[model samples]
Target: MDLHYLDATPTEAERAAVDALLGSPEGGNGLDPGTVHGHGDAHNGGHPNGSGPFPAHGAAHGNGSAHGNGTRDGRDMLLPALHAVHDRIGWISQGALNHICRQLSVPPADAYGVASFYALFALRPRPSRVLHVCTDLACKANGSSELCDRLEQSFGPAGTAVDGMTWQHSPCLGACERAPAALAFEAGDPARTQLLAPAGTDEIEESARSGPADADREPPARESVPQAGDPELRLLHRVGVVDPDSLDDYRAHGGYIALRNALRAGPAEVIKQVTDAKLMGRGGAAFPTGRKWDSTASQPVRPHYLVCNADESEPGTFKDRILMEGDPFSVIESMTIAGFATGCAKGYLYIRGEYPRATRRLANAIAQARERGFLGRSIMGHEGVDFDIEIRRGAGAYICGEETALFNSIEGYRGEPRSKPPLPVEEGLFGKPTVVNNVETLVNVPLILIEGGEAYARIGTERSTGTRLFCLSGTVARPGLYEVPFGTTLRELLDLAGGVPEERTLRAVLLGGAAGGFVRPGELDLPLTMEGAQEAGTTLGSGVVLVFDDTVNLPAMLLRIASFFRDESCGQCVPCRVGTVRQEEALQRMAGGKAPPDGDDLALLREVGQVMRDSSICGLGQTAWNAVESAIDRLGTLSKGGPA
Candidate 1:
């Protein structure tokens, strides 16, 4: 096949950025030895999970499917090259994109399509210092709209450059615990990013102009882990107690002990322990971890891959972010254990782009682990245990949280979901047998291996064994990540978090997330276990326990949730793309009292939602209507769109 060339010429800076990542043109060959930023073993046959041999000083997705090539050479670097140009300049220009295309052997138009896919990447010209203020659910409940209004009053409307500074509304930054958050990203020689929570209009303005220099630091990792320092705490015990940056502290405090245990037990025994524990995935899917590992281990294919789904983009759900931010080393150690047990030599840690601090900490942790002989070829002492981890960053897309979509994103394609049949276990992350697990799920592996599987199983219920992490935000008094046994009731968890804030009466709780259903305050005794929630018509989706008070606007909250799905739908499937838009429109019409000409927007919404639920390719479409339907059924009539 012939590759068409773009006539555009890149700027010197653009050329430099591309060259820095892919290396110089090299006699016009457009290929080189430079990679897309990783510590070691950047090669994955079917995809680029940060293990490809192409070495670069840095980091970023994409149109089309896996292209024809010797596995994935220059093709996988498409996302990273785009990141190079975008990070150097605030956006991806035609010239920069063309340069990247020539280097990667991908068509220029396809490259542009991929660049335009992510919510974070800028295809149009934009300021280097961009302030992304959260206007999604949790933030809105905390007066985020008021902050936006104030910023507009001070500066112009969002997106308009004001003396080289600009601001824009963003979805959840996974900092719902510290509602009304904003993240500042300044692009330059060495790009800098900072998170601002409890964002004051004045503080936002200052951070906007001052850049990341005086940007207010986010709440310490411990703030997110409210139950930190507790002896009974399993996953979060070390979050606030130890220095996250110190390797020695991680060791002295019992880190890597699980890895040692796994090594002694061997891969088969590791699988047995996890299976005995009956550990289900903490990701919304709730699949069995041991089964996933066993299937991958049993695959006859060589070079099995491991992908840590650290990209938690679900609204009102942020347990993964807190875990990575607080305990970076633990993530690495867990991935290492996962790789060792699954017969995989390479691991990909795909973190969300919005988490600047977590990214930095995990990157540091990966480098330190590699340098300390914990990662790479050979074991800490045992040989033939070659395993290494590479960090992959997701550029603003909620759907990438889906497992297949994550593989596509890592493979340098559009972050769109692939139809299942050949699941990640059989053909994933480069069409090879792969094992995928979320941060919270993988972190549980060490615990399971350390404690005997049967003993661990007894900790929780018969089916849903072990502790679960719930991201408590919104009207809760002490909003943070809380850990409790699966059988704990919603009432007990709320009491642990000090119940509702300011003595306000609880109206309802959003279990799971936008993709999960709602429960009325009267149902406080419902257990948090998967079986219990399912029996009540909801799943423990991502462990989101977002509380709402009597003062909250249920209709408006539903509208926001609808808007989020509409904005995030990949448009790969018509039901989801069209249904999401229709859902939002119907709510808006009802909100403004302009009900459809048929005078039955509720009926239209139900139809559209059902179509999406049945026909959509991924869970985003399937569960898009969950919260809204739950609100109408459990809360009350929303036909008038009260206060929306």
Candidate 2:
């Protein structure tokens, strides 16, 4: 853990802020239907019961009212299996969470909470080809709404070819400010939908799987390449530079050149290429990919592992979607290389439940790779190094983004995060040393191996090197994914994103995702670097830059964020469990019409926020006070009944 990025250990004043934010606290217990219907206040009553395990996808579906064979054991078998199916399909198009709940013996609230909490489960069966527009504050400013409208008009019942396509509003696909943005994937394919950005009607429809192509038909021409400024180019880049699923297409774009070289150079030389690249993890915590590989390589474990973290739930980041959908094979190739270097025989790509298409595509690609001799036993006829990969689905807990939590979720347990010490390299997945790399970081391996790591390292800053796939959103004219060198100024990114709104002045920018702190307009000049942001009292969390314009109220905004964390907290630790609820009460009280009487109450709330910050176990409790502190610091004078 780096000290510079973390603030001073929770101060008394900070603890007060946490407490104030959580004005009231609630208890944790199992959810009861009777209590839900007539109880006075379940809000303040207690935590709903959240426990147990079951199958992955053999449950029932329908409206909230039960319709299936109602047996306790039968229902239990059905729930997890239903979740598995829904996770794979993106929504319970044919069944409701309530139906699954009744069939599985889980409370409706618990079932619904699990369904709604994650991004994968959709209440309604989306269009055959789903397009999730990025509507987070950043993309909102970038004309994302307009893009959605355009898409709906063209694809909806009233517009062009309504035969197979459908469009729906998807919450943040994490590509904020990459506006006029959206991610497109087939509903049933599961293999096609990896997170993508800057995608709109034209791009989606162009590459969408409309129908089966003629088996004998020739491939499309590669003559017309799109320019960077072109809208289609932006969408293409967001979908990944290379489309790895198409062997012919990838070959045309110089796809297997790196793999051929890796096979020729052998594992040691391949490892050196990656080591020289200086590529850091694209997944928030910028750990070096080479070092992770080196540790795994040094260990003589027989079945070494290379797991790709594709569970992209960071509120403002979605670069992985592009890699998984556009060039999934790159990830496969990278993992294969890792297996060769580390003497590993297997790999897993942990994709979020929401991205069924990416999962499906990778699964298919893996099968194809095996047939083509790229994976399993001998690769392209070479002996000595053999590898294979599998896909694992996450149940949609944000905490699962934490590595240990991810492992637990994979192990068929509740997705609560775990404390880390015997770091992933030494102890991960079944007590074996593992290498878990971000989707983007693993994809970059092929590039680094093909080109020396030093060449790759030269693109970005000293500490943060290489081109980063930044999911830019909020208040910008053009919102979408941008691959730029690290340390780029906020102003430059904003400009590249087509600038902020003309009518509204800029307010504050949320760097990283929900866990990160804010930077007001005055701080726009702050360099967009991990170290630089830390210096300015914020961290580049998940690299999702969400900018807000003046129309947004900071206090109210902070309240919504606090509420989100409060609702999402797994309730494993008291500081986080009770403290978040308290924070919510304080924010509501302060924001509500009734203002606090001057001294003591205000002081108390502030103190609570600090204690929660200091005492909370995981990232959820620890940094959750960031927005509240920023809000109070920026708007103390404007607060109701305050000095103003």
Candidate 3:
């Protein structure tokens, strides 16, 4: 709640949408039964008109601090409210924005800022339905371009609606296993969304012309777990073996046994086990999970918080999505363990919006967990251990993957990374000690507690303990989630996936992701361990291994990667905001040129990349140049015939 910025009067439909989410104003906050809120007296130069400045008024809210005169602030609901409006109406209207402001005690300008920050929430009016086709790395390697061409011939263009629906290119939908994917999101009561993987033009047309019911539904996440029932598969043992929707199925497979073990052992023992296990985060940072839990638990602060970072938006990474959709109970149980170990009473599972199936399964799991007393007060019949998880959906900003930026997004601000040092463990989520772990990292906790730290530690290299989930996509014969020990070499993993199709020879492997590096075919012997990757001047970042055949247009892929960075940059800091744009421009110039790429363009790329790496606030900016640099240096890409 800031100064009076609500100038426009909301339509009945707009007001109803906000009201549905925030509750009616009748007898409480906002307008009277007959009078509209913010509809100042006509004599005072304010009415329910779309124009005319709002008249000044005293604080109407009951709580106050950093914001305006109001004592009440519903700013945390900003993202959800914007979502409500967008889901009800295809786009966010000025009136609807102002209405949400009044309901949430937020300023109109601030609401507008938050609304425009997300790619999913359109400020202007749009069709009620949207078809998001993936033109990303894995999809491109598949037949995504041809799919787009087919879509173009059927529909007018990507954005223009043929009837009441339209399709547009999207970044990775975290369905990398199913390349050439398309997601349809329709707005209205009981809004519908469907995934169209291996999206044939006919399916897209049918879904667009009629409804998602006419198209094939996405396969269960469990189906994507290639090594599901393998006794050796620690992370994915129950993925396809157990029913995702059943708590009984999860328990029969040994779910919550870790929580019971954890409760009996106490938080201290749990931390010690994780420490001895030497488990690291799977969220690209590879930070020691034990150290993070220890620091947060040791903090003098009260009411510690745990955030399950499930917003997996990395261009070629989708392991977390698979895990959440497959063994959702494990993620929940792990988050519970984390909350208990860290003394956190509340945990937030910040998930991505595109993961509808995962979201649904997680929500169901949370409800079942709460109902069975596995998540509420006195968990497992123990005294005074209270913890619950709330799911937060990210609208579509890659930067929110950064812990601080995620904090900001949850707090209802634009998704942008904040400066560190008062790091997240020290001051996070409402400025408290917080332990944040991604889905894969948290799911491993159950294994550590059950297997004993020493045994879990022995699964992989002594340095990088336990198994790793690699998202093997692109030209590989089998493109899916593969779990292997850390010491496994790239060649071994490729072989495990059956290598590229017999006709297509491997050109290179894009390890990590857009922010990761590229490896030449000869480098396949490199061990798939963190230390191994670092020693080789690259990283196993988030376990993304996107393979490409020699037939792909590699430079175009580089340009697409460049465009992803440029589009996703929050533009809060100059280094990433400007560097990403310049990088894309340089790639376009060099790739578009008929002559050989000049050394000047390559040099310029390096210079800009260095500046971004050195000055960018978050990892997104710091590693923006990583993949491009790897392509240039290792694969000799972006040159005479680059990225091929």
Clashes per candidate, residues 3 or more apart or on different chains: 14, 70, 6
Model 2 C-alpha lDDT per residue in residues 409-512, reported as the tens digit of each score: 55434556667676777766545677888777777777776667788777778877776666666665555567667788888877777666787777667777
Off by over 4 Å in 1: 27-29, 32-70, 214-216, 596-599, 640-644
What lDDT score belongs to each candidate, Candidate 1 first? 0.83, 0.58, 0.81
Regions more than 4 Å wrong, model 2: 1-244, 597-606, 634-644
Q: Which sequence of candidate numbers ranks them by TM-score, best first?
A: 1, 3, 2
Q: Pick the candidate with the highest lDDT.
A: 1
- Candidate 3 lDDT over residue span 450-489, tens digit each: 9899999988998999999999999888889999999999
Candidate 3 TM-score to native: 0.92
Candidates by lDDT, descending order: 1, 3, 2
Better of 1 and 2 by TM-score: 1
TM-scores, in order shown? 0.94, 0.69, 0.92
Per-residue lDDT of 13-105 in model 1, one digit per residue for the tens? Answer: 888877766656664437432344332233221112221123332321112233344266556678777877777887888889888887776
RMSD of each: 3.5, 15.1, 6.7
Reference-based TM-score, model 2: 0.69
